[model samples]
Target: MIQMAKQYGRQSPTTPFLMVRCSAPATWCFFSGTNNYVWESFNNPTDTILPTQVMGLGGMLFSRLTQNNYSRGRFELHFSNEDVKLYLVSRPDDHYYRFEMFNATNASESASYQLVFNESAYINIVKRNGETVPLPLISWRQSTFAPNSNNYYRATLDFDGVFRQYAYPRMRSLIDGDDQSWSVVRYLPDNICNAFPDQYGGSGACGFNSYCRAKGGTPSCECPPGYTLMDPNNKFGGCKLEFPQGCGVLDDELKDPMESYDLANISGLNWPYGNYEVL
Candidate 1:
């Protein structure tokens, strides 16, 4: 792809943008610029986050991923369950990037960015912070160019998952160049986890639990208390009893006998049985 870009004079300032389509699910794509800007797209969204873009909040930036096949990568960046926390996940690698927004309070906010494809591609996020600080910056350089106009670029992912670049062109309007220029588009493919429900533990959900599979979909049943994933084959198979022998056993030390006994305990306990084991 790099060779092609060079052939078209994409390396020069005359070309403002470049667009690349995916193998399938054409909803998402890659955009790049002569100035070293890059971004991914999902048709459009109520809010969007672009690649190699900075979103300031205590000197941080939010970065987007390139399309694996004409769609957003399965990996996602989200806030942690803890107060003002954040995390990045891709399949088994959950919380790949984690951090706290603030140590002082629980205040939260949400917004989106956009993907612009011209001579270059870039994802832009809205500025949420009003106070200015001397934030660190990074630069992404084109590694190679092909005759077909395909090019490769690289950027760094900060500890907070914010991206910074020093050489990329500033955000511009599809019609006019403006710092605040942006537009909301429909989301391509529409759903990010099209094939992996268990991984997401249901849409808009996060975290690792006995009922959530690191690979896909939500577990149908709850894991036995005090126990977590027991079978590696089926992550969402539900948790198993920590100690099978302890099932139905009551701790006599408890002051209340009835309260101390669990589902495993009862004088004439009738075990409800089924193919409860998920492989």
Candidate 2:
């Protein structure tokens, strides 16, 4: 709701127009003029989940984590509603990354990949056991941003998740290929900051803080191993634990309050007799 870009900067232009407005109702948005990224997901929108996206829903439905400002938090992930199977949650705690979704009508021939939007966006999409494999069709070009001029672009995914992409130039700038110079063929995957960090760690295996986005690509983080950081502002809370344990309470003769103990003959215990008789 607020997508504007009409020659606002000027870059090739001859065909590029994108404009969208939403009010929220199972919100879902995705726009990528090939490198200008935008992916918004609020509620529901089956099929078309990008950005290190993972989907496997047959029944059980429970994937929590809403209150960063969305409201609250604590649902984590529950499945068992009937038990279907949909994993792909990795972070400092909740870990998962199982996949299953590549049926294709009945299964004869149908696999696809190549999901790159802009700024080096990424999401190669590759499945093996479950099938689905054959992705490579993202390629685009035509934005020297100056020549014949006639370009307009848009990509949005904002309900709070934040995802954007924009471009403009509808009445100025044109040089090569003329006709108002503005060409964008299709060869995406190089923009989203230079996507590659396990493709945002969707299934690439969460590492830093956890983030894998698609509108193009470029979103990385991962930190879990004894924790560190204190607070860069709050990356989930910046992690903590680095080794600090001591709540006290342990002195009953070294505290052993056993409930049961009997390991055979014990007399100053020094057991481990195998071959030794040198007296």
The number of the candidate with the highest TM-score is 1
Model 2: residues with Cα > 4 Å off, grouped in runs: 1-19, 22-62, 66-84, 88-108, 111-249, 259-279
Residue 181 of model 1, lDDT score: 25
Residues 150-251, model 2: lDDT tens digits: 454433222212222334455653454334432332322333223223223332312233333333333333345555655554343334656643333244
User: Alpha-carbon error at 220 in model 2, in Å?
Assistant: 32
| Window of ten residues with lowest summed lDDT in model 1 | 132-141
231 in model 2: Cα distance from truth in Å?
17
TM-scores for candidates 1 onward, in order: 0.22, 0.20
Q: For model 2, what is the alpha-carbon lDDT of residue 165?
A: 34
lDDT of each: 0.32, 0.32
Best by the lDDT measure: 2
Candidate 1 segments whose C-alpha is farther than 4 A from its true place: 1-68, 79-94, 99-101, 104-129, 133-279
- Cα RMSD, model 2: 22.1
Residue 173 alpha-carbon offset, candidate 1, angstroms = 24
lDDT of 1 by residue, 71-123 (tens): 33223333222221123443434433233223323345433221122223332
